[model samples]
Target: MVALILILVGCNSGKKGEAAAEQKNPKCKVETSLFGMTPEGDSVMLYTLKNEQDITVTITNYGGIITGIYIPDKNGKTTNITLGFDNLEQYLAGHPNFGALIGRYGNRIANARFSLDGETYTLAANNGNNSLHGGVKGFDDVTWVPEVISCDERAALRLSYLSVDGEEGYPGNLSVTVTYELLMDQLFITYEAECDKATVLNLTNHAYFNLAGEGSIRDHILYI
Candidate 1:
């Protein structure tokens, strides 16, 4: 009847352009390998980014989480600045500080007592008696060790975790490496650590930005 309705509307526009190019290049990704479970038995490890003006960034490895950050504004359109907590029991019942990844001694060791070099340490007051970050099981609640070094290109997936010598009380044998690079437009996070027996380190990354998206972004347009 009209050439089969124009061949069924051009085969439904070529299947909607192959479903929008497989949702802009996502071909199944699910491997957090259980980073200490939470957010419903765990599942968060998806890293995909496109630049050169396409802008997209999705990083996850549990506590290596950046979750998602798509950027491109100034009339090009595409923005997702990063803010979080939608699972893991609301990030273990709230307040590990958004974007997580603040560690060892990110800010406080005061009353947790510290007298390194001569000995005299006692931690885990868990922020009140002192000792935040690395105490109460820091490293954003641990659980890392995901490597994807490369397949030749579009690489960079190395999220490490190795903390010994008194878990959070900090002593030594620490090793941390958090690198999630998606070059071209920039989404480079880098942190390297080393310790053998002289504890106390503070790392940070708690991305809570808002360009006016997600719930309660606080009236956008802030320039802080």
Candidate 2:
């Protein structure tokens, strides 16, 4: 089950036009701060992820989304290498790829319904008669209280959310904590949860990457 969670949760677009845009203005020095919020008052924070080489990644608390990744290519030039929408509205609308935290059962459970104990429970069908990430509002879509951790070398933002009973048709109230730690070369994610009643839980962040730092990684190289 954890393996499945790793797949959906464990982890973009333009190239030419992007280079032109970057030439106009080199990106500012990477920084960390509170970005903004939703009309509903949900808080969003941003973190800068740096690699051993000082390559950077910009991530936001909104849906735990990755807004940008600046990596040094073979030539040592920094390029924003991840795919994502320009703003929160686009993210709220929908996303096929880019970055998103998945939850309440990361993958399909067959027919958007499951049987727990002696009773059967049905979930909202958000994905073709199936439930995708705890119905309409999953853990990824909620705001979490954030704690920023830092050191001279790296940084992390610990985030957590509480899911109420009947939220997205799931049983039991669940308290979940997810951590985003930026290490030298990897964004280590930790997800922990507890529930008052029996329920299913799956969590992962969807982030496509190209370690080489350019182009679609699908054709770059893949194993498993």
Candidate 3:
């Protein structure tokens, strides 16, 4: 069995700036190209990040979704180890959260409401009586602006989005950015966000992995 570790953080603060320092002799290559267009005529793009070690990941800005991940097995052969559609239509049509960046709240909120500062805020009941993943049109359903960052040792794609005040019944106008870095034998994902007002915020990357490179997880072992 393979173990996957996800780090999540939520913070409240004023505006902050971040910079990615470039490195020399970088071992990764990043490329971007047109993927498809949305019904609203918005153009979507596909980002490909490949490392010197033969690991590759493909992502799209449509939903900040990872379309595929390629890794080599013991025999020195490489294959995609994640499940996803072949094109944008399949993703736009509908599917589970498959390889998406989930937010403004990653999990469920009981009764679709939460209280803050002695005031109760109502949310969309997306799941039964609970609010799930920021309600019907969370971050996973929106397009994000993307920028490529490179360093001597790695290359990354930084995606940014702005969640307006009262969007999906959540308070505060939030500014969010998620970066996906590709390195030899590893992939690093980092998320940062700041809100203008007091609000509930949770974020996560939803990527289902099949370490064996295919089929059901019946043979995969689990921990925790």
Candidate 4:
């Protein structure tokens, strides 16, 4: 899996609309509001972080998903550069795990089972006969505890979750924290985890980027 580090260089540009008008502070700041509630009656909050560079990113406690990323181009036109839904219902309904945080195991485990310490473990076979992304209800389908970290010129949101032993057939109790930090021209995602027992873990963020804001990617070219 790739390290979830996003660098938005030269993003210091003027923006219009409510996003710009809401910038009462000239420095970095994070604000929160009710995004929605899960079927389990858990409240999910939306966090909006605006850096000094005028880049704005919206994240939800539900799955720690990135809902929007607004950055201005050289022409001073700003658009959301990420693909995601506008509300919580769409997410609960599911749509390719857009902007979600994957965990436990990122890719797939063939036959939905693995052997460790001479013992065999069976996981959820959600993807064909394999275990895909921690099973049917992975970290992406749960609520996370959010904490805001403010510095002189940067904003960060720390999302923490605890996975108990035998969750989705995974052994050991795991504690995970994923932090999204917004700097002048960069967004850093840091993942940290600790387990009481020996268990496999792989974490990553699934975020689709479109520099042109939205639409087809056939004409889009990647540098790396």
Candidate 5:
């Protein structure tokens, strides 16, 4: 039987934007702590979500990154099933998207430029001639304000970020919110956003999972 399941919600906004097997009744829990401090002396926090099934997901405000995800196997053994660093320094140093929240534009814009209503805007071209994942800094590199919400059914961490106009060459001031919820044997993510002006916007979570607990997924079966 398969061991772990990682669900990622990638949200893309163009200006406007489940249950598991039965077991012992366990209450969902959420814990927050200081993850680290940025070079600019900003404090970053880590929020951990634990479900009734003992599955745990750790996320940090720095870049809105999912630092870790722990899931149990059929044998009742738990292990972290995602790739990431142990500290904020490593994340700041750089790595693949790991488990970052990509935004403004998730993919790319050709030539790092776009036109709207006969007006042209130029963006940062970190990915060759195209603008990749928002831009050089993107949403992945910014700090988000976090709010923890809990109820009888689940616990959630709601993170919010405001992208100002002219930032990364985007036209409008965008307000974004992403919530991560822990329920029975599952993780739910929700993303919402609004912009003051008409501007291009897209958002997504880049999380890589390893179901077997280690190694390449070459031997695993995928069903799209």
Candidate 6:
């Protein structure tokens, strides 16, 4: 089994944008609601996690996508910093991965194939001759099973999925679980996976952000 964690902390000082909606509940909590239905007739649900600091995040079961991340600025005005579409249709039609979970390989596999255990395996070449982001339908394109977990002073959403052997030509019965937690002023994303056979796996969340909230980030300086 392999475990990986990603963290996003709320900044005390940040850009300006629309104000966040006021919450009726002051304590940390998680709420569920219907987001939409897939073309295949699957029900997609949304999970909203709110913390004591007034930071709220909305995530959807479809693709484990984060629809919004509302954080307050120094002046107490809150706004969403991530870029994503409004409905499932837009996501189904496709956008640049935006706020979605990426896996079992995050980047391209050159020539749409790989050799493991001295045997060559072919993969779907979605990106020209290369297999991009696990090829054709990645983790970002699947619906995940969700469970609510309890944490001291925090709220969390755990999503799990099983990628059967030979999925997308990969040789493994892979069990993947990802957890999104709201602790204080931070949002933590933890990824865990176990494979029955030797295989390749890389996972990450694709979230496009504008720290300034709306304007171009040309003047922004990136650190690492």
- Which candidate leads the pack in TM-score? 4
Candidate 6 segments exceeding 4 Å error: 1-26
Residue 52, model 5: lDDT of 70
Q: What is the TM-score of each candidate against the true structure?
A: 0.33, 0.77, 0.88, 0.89, 0.87, 0.88
lDDT on C-alpha atoms for all candidate structures: 0.59, 0.64, 0.80, 0.82, 0.79, 0.80
Error of 2 at 190 (Å): 1.0
Model 1 Cα lDDT, one tens digit per residue, 33-67: 23235545554445454544466666556677665
Which stretches of candidate 4 lie above 4 Å from their native place?
1-26
Q: Weakest 10 consecutive residues, lDDT, candidate 2? A: 16-25
Badly placed stretches (over 4 Å) of model 1 are 1-53, 57-68, 71-76, 83-100, 105-121, 124-126, 135-153, 157-169, 179-205, 209-224
TM-score of 4: 0.89
Tens-place lDDT digits, model 5, residues 141-182: 999887766455666677889999999999999999887777
Error of 6 at 5 (Å): 5.1
- The ten-residue window of minimal lDDT in model 4 covers 12-21
Error in Å for residue 96 of model 3: 0.8
lDDT of 2 at 1: 4
lDDT tens per residue, model 2, 30-111: 2456677787976566666554556676777777777776766667777776677677777777776367677777877778
**lDDT-superior candidate, 4 or 5:** 4
Cα deviation of 223, candidate 2, in Å:
2.6
lDDT of 3 by residue, 85-203 (tens): 88999998988888999999999999999999888899888999999988989899998987777555666777899999888899989999997777667677888899989998889
Error of 6 at 133 (Å): 0.6
In model 2, residue pairs whose N, Cα or C atoms come closer than 3 Å (at least 3 residues apart or on different chains), thus clashing, are 9-204, 9-205, 12-83
| Residue-level lDDT tens digits of model 6 in 28-138 | 777788888998999888888888888888888899999888888888889887888788888999889999999889999999899999989998889999999888999
lDDT of 6 at 190: 85
